[model samples]
Each structure stands twice: as structure tokens, then as C-alpha cells.
Target: MEIKEVAYDHPDAVELSDQVQAEYRTRFGYDDTTPLRPSYFDPPRGLYLVAYENGAPVASGGWRAQDAEDEGYAYGDAEVKRMYVTPGARGQGLARRILAVLETSAREAGRIRMGLETGEALPEALALYTSSGYTPTTGFGVYRDNADSLFLAKPL
Candidate 1:
């Protein structure tokens, strides 16, 4: 698999994002309503990545700076978003690869911590994060008040 950094609104990135949102709708009974903008993934602040296999996009993930205490984020925090692996690409370690790159890029950008909000419906994701050294953290973001939401963080 080849992982390439791309704009959050890039065609392939948008395709994968739509796929993830569909999965979210299936699991949560609605699409995630978090407002996002392409610029949020710009360098020096954040990054967006796409993984391709045989020249077809298969996975994606990104991170954005988050430091607003009112939103429950810590200073120098980088929040992960839109992590996904296409159904056919499952079990290939693509998600792990994408996550490692996101963390590395965020860390290099001076982000002191990496944070994300997932949910119990995504057991595999929760497992991946926990095994990668992420631990439970205070909720934040749009889903903070949702009982199904699970927030996790790891110091970079």
C-alpha cells in the first residue's frame, strides 16, 4: 500500500470520506455532523493522507490542530479524523499505517498530544487505538455528549 498526503477535499480523499460517513450512518443511525473545512488539513497545522493499492484509493485519515479548552481540548493537541479502510482492504494493517503517519506528522508539527473521538460501535478501531498506546480521555467535539462516543489520546 502506498500512502500519500493530499488535500482534505481532494477527489480521492472525498470518496473515502464519504465511505466512512456511510459507515457512520450505519452504525450511529446518522451521519456525523461535525463541521470541517479543507484548510483544516493544511500543513504546519494538520495533514490528510490517502492509501492506495494497485492505484485505487483504499483508506484515508487526517489530523487537525485543536487547542480550545472550551471544547475540552488541550493546548498543542492534534485531533484525528475520518480514519477509514475500505471493506476490501480490511486486515491489511492500512489503518495502522495511516495512523502512524498522522501521529508522526502531528508530532513533527509540535503537537504535544494526538486525540480522537470514535465510538463503541467500532470495536476494531478501539482495539487498534488501545494497542497503539492510546488511552481513554475526556470527551470533546460534536459527539462529546453522546454516550456511545469514546475519546482517546496519546502523548506525542
Candidate 2:
């Protein structure tokens, strides 16, 4: 698999994002209304990455800088987003690789921490993040009030 940095609106990136959200919608019966502006994944403040195999996007993820008051986390937090690997890509370690890239990129960008919110519906994601050193934390951002949301964080 090859990973490429791309804008949030990049065709491949958007396709994967939509596919993942569709799965989430079907599993949780809710839509994620997180405020997502392309600027959130713009360079100097954030980044998005897509993993492709044989010219098809199989996985994607991104990180955006966050503020303290609103993020409910420390300043310089890089909130992870849209982490997904297609059904066929499962068990191939693509998601973990993508996550490692995001973490490294966020640290290189001067972020002090990495934060993310994933629902219990995705057990694989929970395991991936936890095994990658992320620990339970107070909920933040869009899912802050969602009972099903499981918040996690890791120091960069």
C-alpha cells in the first residue's frame, strides 16, 4: 500500500470519508455533524492522508490543530479525524500505518498531543488507537456530548 498526503476534498480522500461515514450511519443510526472545513486539513495547521493500493483508495485519515477551551484538551492538540480502512482492507494493518503517519506528521507540525473520538460501534478502531498508546480521556469536540463517543488522547 502507498500513502499519499492530500487535501480533505481530494477525490480519493472524500470517497473514503464518505464510505466510512456511510458505515457509521448504518451501524449507529446517526450522522456525524462535526464541523469539517477544508481548512482543518490544510497544511501548516493540519493534514490528510490517503492510502491507495492498485490505484484504489483503501484507507484515509487526517489531523487538525485544536484549541484548549473548545477542545477541552491542552493547546496544540491535533484532533484525529476520518480514520478508516475499507472493508476489504481490514486486517492488513493499513489503518495503523495511516495513524502512525498522522501522528508523526502532527508532531512534526509542532502538535503537543493527539486526540480522537470513536464510537463503541467500531471495536477495531478502539483497539487500534489504544494499542497505539492512546488512553481514555474526557470527550472533546463535536462528540463531546455524545454518550456513545469514546474519547482518547496521546502525547505527541
Candidate 3:
């Protein structure tokens, strides 16, 4: 698999992003949730990555600078966003690869820590984060008080 930095407009990246958004909505009952946007995707605050196998996108993820206070803390950090792998691409470590890339990107950007919020319904995601060294954290960002959201963080 080839992991590459991709623009938000990249066709395969966009498609996988849509799949991730759909999964979030279906699993958490949200109407229009998404992991990437102009504010995060534009300028020097964010990064998007895609994993391709045989030229087909198999996994993707993004990260962006975020203020800890927004989620009920006071620290400078980066947030892991939009991590997903195609259903057929599971069991091959695609998600872990995407996460390693995103974390490296965040650290290179001078971020000392990373955080994220995922729904409780996503057992696979929870397991991945836990195994990857992300520990349970309090609500962060715009997800403060969201009952279904589980926050996790790790130091870079």
C-alpha cells in the first residue's frame, strides 16, 4: 500500500471521506457530520492522507490544529479526524497505517499531542485507538457534552 498526502478534492479521498461521513451518521444518528472542511483543509492548519493499493484508495485520514479549551481543557494540540478504511480493506492494517501517517504529520507540524472524538458505537475504532496508545480523555472541541462521543488523546 502507498500512503500519500492528498488534497481534499482528490477523487478517491473524497469518496472514502463520504463513506466515513456516512458511517458516522448511520452509527451515531447525525444528519450532516463530516471530518474535513475548508477551515481545516485550507492553509497551514491541516493535512489529509490517503492509502492506495494498486492505485485504488483503501484508507484515509486527516488532522488539524485545535484548541484544547474548545473541548474543555487548556492546551495546544492537534485533532485526528476522518480516519476510515473501505469495508473490503479491513484486516490488512490499513487503519493503523493511516493513523501512523497522520500522527507523524501532526508531530512534524510541531504538535506535541493529539486528540480525537469517536462515537461509542464504533467498537473497532475504540479498539484501534486504545491499542495505539490513545487514552480516554474528556470531551474536546465542539463535542463537549455529547453523550455518544468518546474522546481519546496521546502525547506526540
Candidate 4:
């Protein structure tokens, strides 16, 4: 797979984002409503990545700087978002590749930690994160109050 950094709103990114949102609706009965902007994924502060196989977009993930004390984030934290692998691309380890790239980019940008919120409904995500050395972390973000929300973090 070929992984490339791209704007959050890039055409391919948007298509994959729509797919992820649709998957979210199928899994939790509603789409994720996190307030996100393209600027949030801009370089130096954040980044978004897309992975392609045979020139077809198949996986994506991103990280945004998050340091709001009131929001329970740390001073040098990077929050992961929009991680998804196309249904047909499952089991190919593309998600892991994208996640590794995201972590490396965030680390190079001086982020001290990486954090993310997933859901119980996404067992594959939980497994990938846990196996990647992410540990349970204090919940943050819009879904923090949701009983099904699961937060994880890793030092970068």
C-alpha cells in the first residue's frame, strides 16, 4: 500500500470519510458528530494520511493537536481521528501502517503523546490499538460521556 499525507478535505479523504461515517451509523446507529475542520489537520499542528493500493484509496487516519486543559487534553497531545480501512481492505494490516505513520508524524512534530477515542462496537480497532501499545486513558471529546466510548493513549 502507498501512504500519502493529504489535506483532511482532499477528495479521496472525503470519500473515505463518508464511508467511515456510514460505517459508524451502521455500528452505533448514528454518525460521529465531532466538530472537525480541514485546518485541524494542517501540518506542524496536525496531519492526515491516506493509504492506497493499486492506486485506489483504501485506508485513512489523522491526528490533530489537542491541548485544551478544560477538555482534558495534555499540553503536547495529538488526538487520532478518522481511522478506517475499507471493508474489502480488512485484514491487510493497512490500518496498522497508517497508524504507525500517524504516530511517527505526530512524534516528529513534537507531540509527547497520542490519544484516541473508539467504541466497543469496533473490536478490531480496540485490538489494533492495544496491540500497538496504547493503554486505557481518560476520556475526552464529544463522546466522552457515552457509555460505549473507549479512550486509549500512547506516549510518542
Candidate 5:
């Protein structure tokens, strides 16, 4: 598989992101009323990475520098976001590959740590984060009071 930088507007990237959001809603019973906005990807502080195999996008992930209000739990850090691997690509370590790329990018950006929030229902994701050296962290970002959310962080 090959990893590449992707713009939010990339066709495959946009489609895969939509699929991911749908999966999140299906798996965790989240309302589809509030979509993850496109503007989240535009910035001086965000990085989006996509992984491809056989000329098709299979996985993607990104990180953004934490905002001032996020300092309580994510100071001097970047927040991992939008991690997803297509169903056909599951169990192939594609997610891990995407994560490695994102982590490297964050380190290159001078970030000392990385944090993320995943739903408790995603056992595979929880396992992946734990095996990748991330540890449980206090709530962060817009998910501070979300009961189904599990936060994790790793020092870069």
C-alpha cells in the first residue's frame, strides 16, 4: 500500500470519509443530523493522509494542532481525527499504517503528543490504540461529556 497526502476535496477521500461517518452512526447509534463539517480539514494546523492499494484509497486519518481550550488534556499536542479503513480493507493493518503516517507527520510538525477520541463500541479501534502505545486519557475536545467516547493519548 502507498500513503499519500490528500486534500479534503479529493473524490475518494470525500467518499471514504462519508462512509466512515455513516459507519459511526450505524455502529454507535449517533444521529446523522450533524455531519462532520468540511471546514474541519482546512487550516494552517491540520494534516490529512490517505492510504491506497492497487490504485484505490483504502484507509485515511489526520491530526490537527490542539486549540487553546483543549490545553487542559491535550496541551502541546495534536488531536487525531477521521481515522477510517474501508470494510474490504479491515484486518490488513491498513489502519495502523495510516496511523503511523499521521504520527510521523505530527512529530515532524513539532508536536510532543497526540490524542484522540473513539467510541467505546469500536473494540477493534480500542485494541489498535492500546497496541500502538496509546493510553487512556481524560475527555478531550467536543467529547468531554460523551459517555460512549473513550479518549487515548500517546507521547510523541
Candidate 6:
């Protein structure tokens, strides 16, 4: 597996984003509608990372700077987004690898915490974060007040 940093609109990255949304539609009954700008993932503020297996993108995730009061944000809250691993790549730790990369990159970029909003349907994602030190928190972001939403935070 190769972990590579890329622009959010990079061809491969865009492809994976679509794939993630497709899965999300099936799992959550709707696709995420939040606006995502490529610049949001640029360094000095945040980053986007993709993991490739045999040259095929398998997993991806990114974080962007957010004020403490902003949705999906808390202390050091660089809001995590688009975290996903392809079905064929499950159980290989690719999701965790991408997550660690996001956390480390965000910390190096001067962030002190990480936060995210996920839906209840994504047990795998919640499990990954919980086992990696993320603790339950209140909901924010597009899913705020949504009964099926789950929020988590971690100190970087």
C-alpha cells in the first residue's frame, strides 16, 4: 500500500469521493451535501490523503480547519471528512492508516484536536475511532440534531 498526498480534486481523489458517496447513499439513504473545496485540504490549514493498493485507490480521508463553534468542530477541531475504504480493502487496516495520516498531518500543521460527525449506520468507522482513542461527543456539522448521527473527538 502507498499513502499519497493529493489535491482534493485530483482525478483519483475525485473518483474515490464518488465511490464513497455511492456507498453512503446506500447506507444512510442520502448522500452528503456539504460543499467541499479542493483548497480546504491544502496544507497550512489541512490535508487530503489517499491510499492505493497496486495502483488502485483503496481508501481516503481529509481534514480542514474549523472554528471551535463550527459544525463538525471542537477544540483543535480540524473536521474530518470523506473517510472511506473500498469494500475489497476491508480488514486490511487501510482506514486506520488513512486516519493516522490525517491526524499526524493535522498535528504537524498546528492542529491540536480532531473531530468528526458520522452516521449510526457506520459501525465500522465508529469502532475504528473508538479503538483509536476517539471518545463520544455531541453531534455537529450537516448531521447536527440528527437522531442517527454520532460525533467523536480526539486530542492530537
TM-scores of all predicted structures: 0.98, 0.96, 0.89, 0.98, 0.88, 0.94
The model with the greater TM-score, 1 or 2, is 1
Report the lDDT of model 2 for residue 155.
96
Which ranges in model 1 have alpha carbons more than 4 Å from their true place? none
Pairs with steric clashes in candidate 2: none
Tens-digit lDDT string for candidate 3 (1-156): 898888878888779878987887788777334345646854367788889889999898888888647457446588888889889899999889889877887888777888888877999999999999999887866776878888899999
Candidate 1 residue lDDT tens string, 1-156: 799999999999999999999999999888888899999999989999999999999999999999888888999999999999999999999999999999999999999999999999999999999999999999988888999899999999
List residue ranges in candidate 5 displaced over 4 A.
31-44, 70-73
Mark the regions of model 2 whose C-alpha exceeds 4 Å error after superposition: none
Which residue pairs does candidate 3 place in steric collision? 71-140, 71-141
Sorting all predicted structures by TM-score, with the top scorer first, yields 1, 4, 2, 6, 3, 5
> What are the per-model numbers of colliding residue pairs?
0, 0, 2, 0, 0, 0
Which runs in model 4 stand beyond 4 Å of their true positions? Answer: none
Candidate that beats the other on TM-score, 3 or 6, i.e. the better one? 6
Kindly indicate the candidate among 2 and 6 with the higher lDDT.
2
lDDT of 6 at 53: 93
Point out the worst 10-residue segment of candidate 6 by lDDT: 68-77
Which residue pairs of candidate 4 clash? none
Give the Cα error of residue 32 in candidate 4, in Å: 0.7
**Residue 35, model 4, lDDT:** 99
Tens-digit lDDT string for candidate 2 (7-81): 999989889889988988987997678989888999878999999999999999999999867657678899999
